[model samples]
Target: MKTTRTAEGRVRAVIYVRISQDRSGAHLGVDRQREDCEALAERNGWEVVETYVDNDMSAYSGKPRKDYRRMLADLEDGTATVVIAWHTDRLHRSPTELEEYIDISERRGVTTHTCQAGPIDLATPSGRMVARMLGAVARHECEHKAERVARARLQKAKAGEWGGGIRPFGWGVPTGETATKFDKATGEEVEVPVLDLDKAVPEEAEALRVGADIILTDQSIHRWVRWLADKGFTSTQGNPIGHQAARDLLMRPRNAGIAVYRGEEIGKGSWEVVLDEPTFRAVVAILSDPSRRTTPGPEPKWFGSMIYRCGLDGCTETMICSRSGGANHPSYRCQTRHGGGRRGDKLDEYIEDLIIERLSRPDAHDLLLPGPGDVNVAALQAESEQIRRRLTDLAGLFGSGQITMAQFTEGSDMARAQLEGVNKQLGRAAVKDPLVPLVGAPDVRVAWKAMPLDQRRAVLRALMTVTVRPARRGRMPDGGYFDYETIEIGWKRSAQR
Candidate 1:
């Protein structure tokens, strides 16, 4: 944030240049400020023996400015008789900093100059008063500007527009570059991200396409990431995409054309949609609640990604597989006495045999297809309810005279507009479960058998839900043995479609 130079002279001076913001990343404001400061020193016949700068650093933050301190030290050491800056505000925005600087300048008898605010004599009361007033005004301006920027960004978010961070995956600028404008206030060039519509990131969009395919599962999503990396795909920062990152890219609502703010889906994004809502929701369900909710690890290959909960009659606990009967006999057992060890092969083969039989049916394919209608009516209904609540709140504000009629009308219109859009979308939504295609296929048995563990779990979700229970213990003629009953199956009625 600083630059320095050394020169020799008896009447030596140090120039302190500071800029609060450098949006262009070019440091142009600092450059111009330095130029003006140098010209001021030459006109006054002051020899600039050194230069100190604090670029893109705010004095109002109360953090020590390194060059500002170094310049002060140079003054105390008798290295420079006068200090110059683009303005006193550039030197400080804090009234406290001005007061402290006044003591130092007065004791050390140092003269300070600005290209715009003219010279300041800290030794006198009037000069000190002027500095204090300027400091207060500058601080006020800084705070007001910050508030305005924050409000602007919030409005953008509310409108479902892009606000911060790099362009999201599966989105890019159609124009291939952002527009630029000269900011008169800072005299610097700034790129405007809002000017151009970001379409899709091409290679990344293809990855989203692969994600939308019913064939791709969370297990396959990682392979896709590696495959894309091989195709030269990288993040906006040019870093290799990791496993979880790829899952988020495919499953996050933002990638599916929805705009989320603070963990809530606010509305549709202005960017082009990559995956349809049904496909996106399907991916989310598979990635969020399936057997392999996290990255694939050392789960036994025999488990087949099915999440089994302990379903012993009268026992309400989830089942976890563990080694039983010494080191080798594995079982899916319930903690309750009503539950007994269900042999791994017995249970696994039973479920697979069930799926193979169910998929082989003539009308079962229809069940695999997503049911027609709004995908998530609960979320949409909640949103609509919130809008009504907002309108009620706005009316209350108006009645209490807290807001003008114009303000109330504006707020009401915004809420109603959002409600209308949400209602329209809600009326139009039809859910297509992700696993519908696989099970609905003529060769569903082959497809089910060929599916990866994660994909197979998705199928389990689309067609039927399974629960296991321990059967009554059976006693042999010579001894006793443990046994489990057939699992309870709850098939969704939609599969009949």
Candidate 2:
């Protein structure tokens, strides 16, 4: 066994430093931490191998940084025997990350030292106990800070006070010590005196004009943001507002002269209201309306749109759903007259209805509602496992000089393609399950009536594999003979009743 003195002299160390945000004096913390870590390393006769510094990065979540994860990998691979930091909390606030480091220390024979907390020999039981206790304290501190900040926001919101952040579009921040308001409609300055808590309307209006209000309501802010964007207004950051950001702003109540923070109301005594009650209510109404809100360009027509195509040869024309002359009766018409070689024969509404009825029969249930059973699931899982194993084997072969680079690359590509195909099939199977029972149900007509256009299309695609040529007559059935002999109808399970 090696003596303690020899082991101590041979210890290799790495230093890690991190600061959450770039404050005016952020460099001071980084420099101080480095200095402390180096001093501890030198005092223990440990040879410092490398230094990893993460500036302006949070240790709370153990996310948003590549260097931090890389450090863990290095430790796991035995690249570093010891880690030195200013404090354990500086290394990690997340319990999971802390646990990972503890595991690495135990399995890889690594030790951690903090300038403030001294040596933590993770190989020993006492050291692990200390590390766990410290990790818990750090996690508590992070959570406590989050709770405190949340509480502060709630208090500020309840008072209808501006929480001292970026001003929204359609409003200007008050400059200096004096309060002033700008007219959004006229782009002119207006002298509006600040008011006490008694006068809510004027105060709120002033807040709105100055962009000092926090929206606090169920009303969506997307409509308002889009409206502002359409009017050539931008956010306080000089960036166009996104849908989600706009929604977040509108949902906050503080902008509407009411304050709510952390699920509680804490009205601000000094903050003035930005918008009048009537105007706020109107904005809310406009945002909540399904028709007025612009997303995906309207809900689209429920049926009778140009979404269907005739698949018959020589008659491969698109179908248009239209209402009969002077009537609300819907019908499907081929685009090309006499295109299908069957002259004067057109597909009528009745035939389409009959096809839908037939497809919805109980006998077609298996074709419509095929889901992944145990066999299919097991096959997919086994294929996935095989792909993973092949990749691993190829990597090993390459590493051991048993396979050429070209061969490895080719094998890897094939494995990846197979894996992708299996994944896609698995996804399709998931969607296929619902379609089977739906298409076979006897009451498919009712189902068709209730389903939206997109869902109807999905069912149509799953059931109909071939389009049947229709006997078409070009001119109206009651009129002179016209072009086109046949029309085509695709037979598939009907999702609609």
Candidate 3:
């Protein structure tokens, strides 16, 4: 039979130490544990690979530490063969975690040894059983301690005793006195002993109260956090209270005198409630009302307020929507005939009707409609591609520090303009008849209703471009109200194309 070597080349080990609180003066167990582990490693010819210390973190919840998890990962990856700790309890105070650790040790061939408990050989059935039993006892102790603490807190709360936790917003513990101190400014209780009203300046106290109100009413906890940071408020540990702390402070109901601790009120006698019961009820009612909620309004009309010049010469004024009649019968009058110009001719709604009738004809439709041949897809694609390339290049230049801020901005603007032009061209090519089709489409009404004011301007720009010049009366072949003449209507499309 081959004998297993008692000592390998060199045992690599990691040391993990922890303390739940800064009670170093009361208990030097952690220090002593560390010393013992170090001595053990030296005597066994083992190298201390790394030391992971998790101070002030209770292992009751089996909450894994960042450093502890990293050490585990390293062990699995062959970084360390052994783990050294004060005892099994130091590694984990929970049975579930200890069982997991034992399984990992057995599978990964990693050894766990404690300063007081000696080696935990998980590969052997007897050793594994002992470890599991120890883990159970530790977990039971932790659970029992937690239950006792919780019962004590509940009893204190029922008796209206100040169960130790966070301090209330406005009340503070009295200085050199047994009672709590009340904030004169907001009349709220400050529960923290160090944050007494006498210690805080009048202005600072006022600001804190105001910031707390803003946080509660506006639900802007971030603003309150910023205010606390600026004022140099910190936790009991002398570290700044994080964003979560500010949120908790604002949400605590004990400051408002409504918090039920066990069966009694804790800080009721110390602080005044900012939001009383009646006011809170009113706010809830308003928030729950459906009628108070806001929704988006209707879209604006493109030519709702703009003036449109008529094509008939001698018209005193341009065509306008009728105030009394419906939009369909709205007529354009020659300004001169109406009273200002030469030969005045009134262009009734018949002109618009005639234009619509002509557009419906197959011959006219073919002439106006955009066919496949009319669209230059390749040219449009090239223009879009160029714009995209320019945008990318400008972004690259900005990233590489090759272009100044102003230069990058200018390049971006130009590229955007080019891209917009290409998009307009493509849009126009897709339409059968730019002006008429848009006006006649059934969806135009919906589009008009859905569009905003800015989008309305874009629509107007797409339909018409130039001012329609009125036709002269004598220039018409027949100088009568009923005269036949071909109308020349000029309009502008978007310059983007």
Q: Of the pair 2 and 3, which is ahead by lDDT?
A: 2
Error of 3 at 459 (Å): 39
Which candidate has the highest TM-score of all?
Answer: 1
Stretches of candidate 3 above 4 Å error? Answer: 1-8, 21-32, 177-252, 261-497
Instruction: Choose the strongest candidate by lDDT.
Output: 1
For model 3, residues 1-497, the per-residue Cα lDDT tens digits are: 11112246576788888776643233355677679889888888888878887766788865667777777676667666688988888888776777777777777777888987889888778888988888888888988988899878756554444566554444443565443445545555555334442133344345446544443233334556566778877654466766555545444444334434543223232334454332232233323346532331332222422334544443424433332234333333333334222111233233333334443444433333344476576687566656756766786799799999899999989877876566555544433233343344455445444544433433343434323353445544554543334343343332121
Question: How many pairs of residues collide in each model?
Answer: 12, 54, 20
Whole-model lDDT values for every prediction: 0.70, 0.59, 0.55
Expressed as tens digits, the lDDT of each residue in 1-497 for candidate 2 is: 22212345567778999888754433667888999899998898887877888887898865766677777777776677889999998888877877878888898888888999988999889998998899899999889998898768756654555555555333343433445565555666667544333333433244243221222221224334544566665555677767666654543545545444444333333444454333343344434557644554443242323345555565556465545455444545566533332211233333436546765666655454443453365576567557756876887799899999999999989987886666555443333232543565667777765754455544544444323355454565657543223333455544342
Judging by TM-score, tell me the better candidate of 1 and 3: 1
* Model 3's TM-score against the true structure: 0.42
Model 1 C-alpha RMSD to native: 7.8
